[model samples]
Target chain A: MADGNEPRVFRIRVRGSDVVASCAETEKALIALEQAVAFPRPLPVNVGCRKGGCGACRVKVLSGDYTTIKMSRAHVTEQEEAEGYALACRIMPLSDMEIEPAFLSPRERMEMRQAQKFAD
Target chain B: MSQEGLLRPGIAQLRVLDMDEAVKHYVEYLGLEFVSKEDDGRVYLRAYDEFHRHSVVLREADQAGLDFFAFKADGQEAVDGFRKRIEDFGYTVDDVPAGEMPGTGARIGFTVASGHRIELYADMDLSEDAPETNSPMIWKTMPRGMRAQRMDHCLLYGPNIEEVEKFFTEVLDFHVPERVDMPDGAFAIWMTVSNKAHDIAFVKHDEPGKLHHLAFFLQDWNDIGHAADIMTHYDISRDLGPTRHGITRGQTIYFFDPSGNRNEVFSGGYTAYKDHPTRVWDHNSVGRGIFYYERQLNDAFLSVVT
Candidate 1:
């Protein structure tokens, strides 16, 4: 759902699902998803030690004009930067892009649910 | 069914300093709940609307690194079995009583390969039943499929790769999935028996303490971006890109904590469970080099060696 005044600028594809929006940056894209689309479930954000030091909030920028902000070199290697990857916490999308979340799987989710049931 | 070799341990509790800071970070940032706090500056935190006493423990300490802790074992027999295996290697084992900590039950003690003190025990009286609160932010705006299962694994920086690897594989029964080699013929290994690529990874650090980073698994890709947005709102510095590793094909992002410890959240690691007698590669083999991308050295990594 694009606001009439907002220009139809770029598109973002998440996990093979294409999402079109007028938002220009990655942050805006996420906000748009929250407002415009119905997600299957609630997402978890553990932005622990937000200083890019914690790596807990990392996301991959598959395609976009994104740049990181003051990321520590020790945390990410030089080889990692060139391969079209940017930290979601530090990355600000300058253009339309696609990004992927790391480490989420259906089987893992089932295990978690089972763990919760056992705990209960 | 027999539960012979199952790692059915849940997080007993993480002990950290500064209850207020820990609470604010884990609860507000990570979406965990402050189940309870004590006057002694210890805080217990839980995740995923769970009824367990606490998944992480934050306690007051002069230093802010990981304090002593334990993982849950299935039962008394499992603890004894694990103890026999460890003691056969000539490491001492001790028995600690429950009630010393709020959520912890009975426990057996041993040291990890990285020389960290660890406890293995079972039958800590966990709260039988608890309700799941529909917290406003719990399930909204979630990625297509998002559910944090449990504390998946921890990565440690070890100076001696062979020593640590042997300790885990031989003494603790951890399986090695992949080992990347340094150009100079040394090895950096990732080991785990769980379905995920590596429950615990060991990287060669110039120094002898925990150097690399700690990682947790997420159930959804969208949460990665959402979590990043939350970090930006807090004005924290970002460390690295969310790149896919050539070796594991696992996507990863790295950052630092207030104390400068590195943490990583990665997904989609290739599993080696089916391949029971997995092939072991040489430290200088070509296959090892594929996963890691060559990066320009920065001052931080350089400083560690210098």
Candidate 2:
């Protein structure tokens, strides 16, 4: 349990980029990263679905001390979770960590590119 | 007046699809009178209203769905009513400091029933505005859809459908018009305080957050075809149709914006009220044709990885 007194440190890594920031609690870290980064879109961070059931938001922790809210079977598999993949939206960072976001596929990239061209 | 006591009244307008093509198409073909263009490339569009300036804003982005926008509550009292109800349900509300912009009036902050951060303001002062250059491809030659009044509703994607639905209905006091339960008994809730069926909805999905298409209601159904024809002329008719949704009784057409975000131009939706208690139904209650529709991305259009 977090005591709210002990100063915590966190090092976060966003996917497809090397920008990282360190901050005090998990929420502050997440919010700070959100404000600092110019994301291609709003990163789908977790709301309250911390249990991982909602899959509303998920991020993989590359290296860190963390815990996930209970997940639903439909959202994630035990094997996936076991493979160092934790939902970024659900887990509270306990210590310094690294993370990887499951990015869009190549074909999806093409579509996005085409859409961007049209917009421009 | 205490800022915490104020609730943003009704949705002013929602930014649907961030694509350039979609925004341009709406401006040129559908007859959405262009309002202003921001230096950051954000374009403001509006339908003529008795009260305010442009009702909707379309920002250029790589990903689609409802992006950020504002809401206008009835009065200071309504804003206060929302603040009380939100805190009563255990959530944080704050007053957005002034001078963020020149004309925007006193604005407060609160999360929506669905947990999205939103800003509410009263007395928007856009008195000294300038006109923007008109696009060459104006749809003056063709008929158009209902002059959309304002962006009124935002249908969001919620992976944990049940929890989100509960947050909106119980916490924020929105009326649930219809609920679709999954085979496992989880549910997607449609809640609204507006006369329209729902100002917001919680959809069940695999990926969560606001990764769904956002819509704006045209004044009438004919405007739908007008907008579609405009897109067709632009050679950008990705998709168009009149499909019904079981949850909110909305008839809609799905199309891509220039930025690859999905946008819907809809009309003929119902509303919820306090006197009429909300109705709930079983999961298998509605037909698949009306309730469930295909959301195919064709791999090429998928841009953002979240």
Best by TM-score: 1
* Clash count, one per candidate: 32, 24
List residue ranges in candidate 1 displaced over 4 A.
Answer: A1-120, B1-3, B6-9, B12-17, B49-51, B125-149, B183-186, B209-211, B274-306
DockQ winner among the candidates?
Answer: 1
Best by lDDT: 1
lDDT of 1 by residue, A14-118 (tens): 654554444544354444443445543433322334444333434566777755664433334354556654434555556677777542122343364456569
Native interface contact recovery, all models: 0.17, 0.00
Writing each residue's lDDT as its tens digit, candidate 1 over B220-270 gives 556666656765686433455455555456665555544345545566767
lDDT tens per residue, model 2, B1-306? 322322323323333333355466566644566666777666666543323455566654323345444566556676667677767767788876554433455666665534455566665554233232366332233333434544556556535666666655565555676666657765556666556676666555444444345566765666666766655676443433555565566666665544333556777776566567666656456344233353222222222211
Question: In candidate 1 chain B, what residue range of length 10 has the lowest lDDT sum?
Answer: B297-306
